[model samples]
Target: MYADVTVVGAGPVGLVLAAELALSGVTVQVLERLAEPETSMKAGGINVPTAEALDRRGLLPAAERVHRETMERMGAAFGRKAGAGAGAAATPSDGRGAGAQRQMTGHFAGMVIDAGLVDWDDPDLAAHAAVAGARMVPQRELEGLLATHVERLGVPVRRGVEVTGFEDTGDGVLVSTTAGAIRTGWLVGCDGGHSTVRRLAGIDFPGTDAELTGRVAVVDMADSSVLDEGWVWSSRGAYRRGPQPGRVFTVEFDAARRDDAENAGTRPHRGAPAEPVTLEEMQASLRRVSGTDVTLTALHGAATRWSDNTRQAATYRSGRVLLAGDAAHVHSPFGGQGLNLGVGDAMNLGWKLGAVVAGWAPEGLLDTYDTERRPLGAWVLDWTRAQAGVMRGDAKSVALREIVAELLATRSGATYAVKKISGVTQRVEVPGDHPLAGRHAPDIRLADGSRLANHSHAGGFMLLDRTPDGAFARAAATWAGRVRSVPDGTDAAGAARAEPAGVLVRPDGVVAWAADEAEATPTAVTALEAALHRWAGAPAHEPVA
Candidate 1:
């Protein structure tokens, strides 16, 4: 076998998965159809959970640098001063005191939600408060970062190599590529919405058809003054201008064609149109949506046409062939969830798949990836669907949008939206009832000023024991090889509840188990052992030298 695992696609998700597999001592390789990384602007930024995932991998510094550069360019294009940093709190222009800054958490449809309205004092939002917020890094830059990381990890990413077909023989998968045929224990498809791997694997992709066509482009215009800045909603559709100059976005309702007869009941060309976007199409889209005769003269970079084609895989895994990122689920780029969702998929699946390939995974461990992440993918599809519903030009949609806007203006509504959009409220089912259990562990600070994130750079489970007697640490010794014990964390971030004696954080940063007692009782110890067996697999059964 060339490698234990073969990942089809060299995007952020595949690179991340490859890196995790390499870190976990499993051989992995990535194959991408494109000879070079795409330079188009896809996702404009990442949400909190994605940012935290980068932080856990020690890539946040590079991401922050890229974010700052992106922000500076955006600020220059908009003729405004950039924020102090990528995740720094912005001071409101109106000077409405400390908490009044307009937090650009995200927008639902065209209505922007201000996270500033959220009560920071609320315990539910403590995890968000403990970490850096959302960031504006371009997708191209992020791919560069991940590509570099995977290269450093010695994972081979062979471009210009497309997977033509694959056969899963139960024992392993034989992947036929343009270069040659290779044998691998596992095959993961991260190749985007129209995945050849998914098609070859015969996984069912079922979802709603596209309703509207949206165009986003950076272009030179004959007269830029004809269009309005920011979001402009009309009876026709909606158009947004000048988050950066020359960058325009238009969404026209009832503009997308339904699934064609040949493509019906399968992965349709409903997301991005198969044709390359042109200046004439951009001008026509802007004219219809803005109700203005704006003329785009020339396209600057790549122009993209997208639709609200929402879909999710019936199953993320079929025998030894699996899927992640857009290959697993796809939806409208509304709420900027596509990239973040894909990154989340990579994070959630990487370690588990790695454990499986490394030969120490407990029974049914690999299946948990599908069980846990599929629901999140479904939720994202619905989230974007709701946004699409409110974005239509019809009167009913307008009325619904008004009500949603009003709800979003309220404290509770805004808080809920922020928590959901920022991913602070995301939790998977785990063994414990503790609030932190199954959720991403907060970056707890140790006595040495290091953080739980610091220990995760090497890709291992973390046992943050806060008990005075190091009870949890002692209990975790049997899994010492797979789980690192940090017994002296002070939780300076105050993100954890006062009672949690310890937290067993999975390599993906999700809390597998947490105990609230001051000391680790026999019951707590047993629970910890069970969690270890469940997540990190069986203990080493040998004393450390």
Candidate 2:
């Protein structure tokens, strides 16, 4: 009935958040509505930053294994097809196959990025590749792993229940769920787009209207090679064929035809729950949009009805409650940034929330969750909007798409596109003189030969000391239990990568502060104390036994 944090929704974001909190020694609970796990591979593809975040938590191997298995499954599915169509019987490219590109980092609108051409050593772009390129795994599989990890942390995930409502009691929150009521220090909603907790918290979800209706389905087609060989953009909309026999993806930008969904077929109206799309409706839509009589013999599973109606919560927090994932923002699924963005939110908020509960968080540390993540969410919204804007079936939009594609052919343009879409260039504004500060700290190998990631604790900060000066070490000793000092006055041999004299990394692996010049003077020690206080509150000053 009582816990440090109660997370609503057992999706990837919620499970990850709960697990992170529990890993930080915070008691947590997860409530999910569905009694069982979903088998459908809904969300797929995590960006490079996501891969890095997972690796930082020692979760990369499992995720990569899932991705490998999924790739094999897709290959098998394609192999059984009657005819060789788009990507059927295809051999792995160097990730760059001329006009037809295979994206490992994802795409912008429909323009996929060939990551092989990228310089992974570039500081701005390389920050995203700390664990290699982007990885793709089924959403269900990812959630399953998260659930397992959370279970390992002893966090109970109660399925077949949901957060019905809650009341903020100032000090804590009284959560009302289908199972029962409970009191928790904080409540976070990661319950997908149509979130019940957000409604209960009276959060304002304000955004744009849904102008385009879309559908993605798995079907048994009479002819595997019926669709085009590659991405086909036409007067109706854009369309693409997946790797398997029946997997077909389509979009319809015709407003008049979209309105017909309300009559009885597929009502994809804005501000309404997406109705179950019928096979007949999909067939009609495909035929109408493509103007080709493609026979869909059988529907493999339920079709996903999507729209371009992007919306984000006015704010991520409301008193004792907070929101993340689709609950906090929703947008067009042009590129698979949603999962990465949501999981990143969990990675950012988890430690902050744990810090607050543990009573070491600096002033406004909790507020920064909304301040930092909200803009990133809005940035994604704008990215998706821009993609959708150039993807309108109109001549102007189509022309713009062509221009964008042409521009993407250039090195700088492609780099820019990939950087933005891969979430590599995003740098948070932290109070520091060094450019690397407030950014993701460089992964450093300590003098003891341990990786920076290995020393990172879920609830504590890491101080990387590279200089052969004991000033930073002395200052760090004052906050020893709170902020761990990695190197003790170790010199050039202290780091695996070239780094500054001293660096303090947040639990989230972001550089809080770093010294530009190495000096074992009182000035350096004083500055270290100030930085330590600014980020982790006043030092614990542990008393000697």
Candidate 3:
């Protein structure tokens, strides 16, 4: 309607997609039902991978203002267990339940630190001191920052507006909202787990059934000076003995038990406007497990319902309408990958959407969005499902967790998990006999007093190492209007690998082609031409219906 792209829902995911599109000069509109960002601390942490994505977009500094503060507080708690003189009360022994013992017994037992931020001495860490590691920004703060970033991009976000319906007109779609109707060439649904846009598109989210369990207490009590870190308290059955532990813990709350106890109704009733649960009920649950009176100043009510309904949509696109974030896939939040996964989807789609809108992409380029992301979404769903089972104390899940944990004790295993979960190991449509194919191009320092790392948002095909040969150089000259290249002398390792004298990289930072030095100059030129075609380097004027 008023914009080229209409984004449904103004949550963090939608805001990111909108900001990215608008930054690339796309006319974008974001519709949100909420009048403003929420104050609830629904989400507690952002893992390492998300921090990298934020850093790439240069939002890390502003994000750090909040992230660092929250992380510092979380870190203090986590560190207490590892700190000297930290007693068993602060630091529980290397404790394992059926699952933890089975999966991680004999595995390296040590304090866990953020892998992405592991190398504190790294130069980049020192340079970007503001956002150092997995930021601990609460859900509300994250939304606020993202919303502000979107507004600064000149994109208009309409809050308190709900999308009612839409129809595809073959060329564009007419989106009807509670506010008004608008027409847009494209749409992205980032409307969370229960998505209205997804329903309108008629996509099926099929998978395993959901697992419902747990009642949670979110108390804002005077900080328990003794308990700094988050801990789970457990007992033989039902409620634990006495006072609650710290401010957070997951306790089983069944409907039957609530009916038996006066204060243990279906939902918690604190002093809030909502129903209230007595401080005694909360304290008693904690005491049964930790044997302590976890003092409380304020109490917030929450309940947990885990679903194994690990789901992914059959497709991410339907003509002009598309989906991202929880709208496309959902899994248990055990590993805290839900938000990060959603953010990654937006990042991956953002560049492609820009290319398509700018007329540089082939017709099938948009098709790759579903092909690439849907599979990954499915994969993450599996991982989270497995992890969820472990969290819920399943014996089989515990055994599998222990096996994986044991394997992960090795350097190779840890590195593999680190890369996989970090989303840096992502690969896309790279077909060839080349060794670099299907692998992320390791960031290499160039010898030419320049580095590929120096480039900001280095989207599109990048020639990592270029040739000095006249024919090879001439080939690059031909694609000068399309790809960007640097001389091979820039990096020694890249130069050594240079045959036609350089390498071709994809927009997602994967190596596409590498030249063999033994090949003839003609062969090198031919290779360049082949790569140009493979990467859709033809002029943007190429017609598309």
> Which candidate's TM-score is highest?
1
lDDT of 1 by residue, 1-545 (tens): 38999999888888888888898998999998988777554777787778778888888667667756666676676666665422233332111123312344667786776565766555555544333422666677788889889999999989899889988998999989899999999999988888788888888888888888788888888899998777789888899885655788888877576644322211212132366788898999899887878878899887777778788988999999988988888778888888888888888888898888778999999999999998898999999999889988789989999999999999988878877877877889998788898898865656666666877899889898887778888878888779889876345554433546788989888999988887678998889988988888878876465
Residue-pair clashes per prediction, in order, are 0, 1, 30
- The true-versus-predicted C-alpha distance at residue 46 of model 1, in Å, is 0.5
The models' CA-based lDDT, in order, is 0.78, 0.70, 0.56
Model 3 misplacement above 4 A: 42-49, 60-67, 75-145, 214-218, 221-295, 299-308, 394-413, 433-436, 439-441, 446-453, 458-461, 469-482, 486-488, 491-505, 508-528, 540-545
In angstroms, the error of model 1 at 402 is 0.7
State every prediction's TM-score relative to the real structure.
0.92, 0.87, 0.72
Ranked by lDDT, the better of candidates 1 and 3 is 1
Give the range of the ten consecutive residues with the poorest summed lDDT in model 2.
Answer: 261-270
Candidate 2: regions farther than 4 A off: 74-103, 116-121, 243-246, 256-273, 446-450, 457-459, 488-497, 518-524, 542-545
Q: Give the clash total for candidate 1.
A: 0
TM-score of 3: 0.72
For residues 116-233, could you state the per-residue lDDT of candidate 3 as single tens digits?
Answer: 3233233222222222332555566787888787777777888888889999898888989888888898888888766778878888776655553333456655545534343342
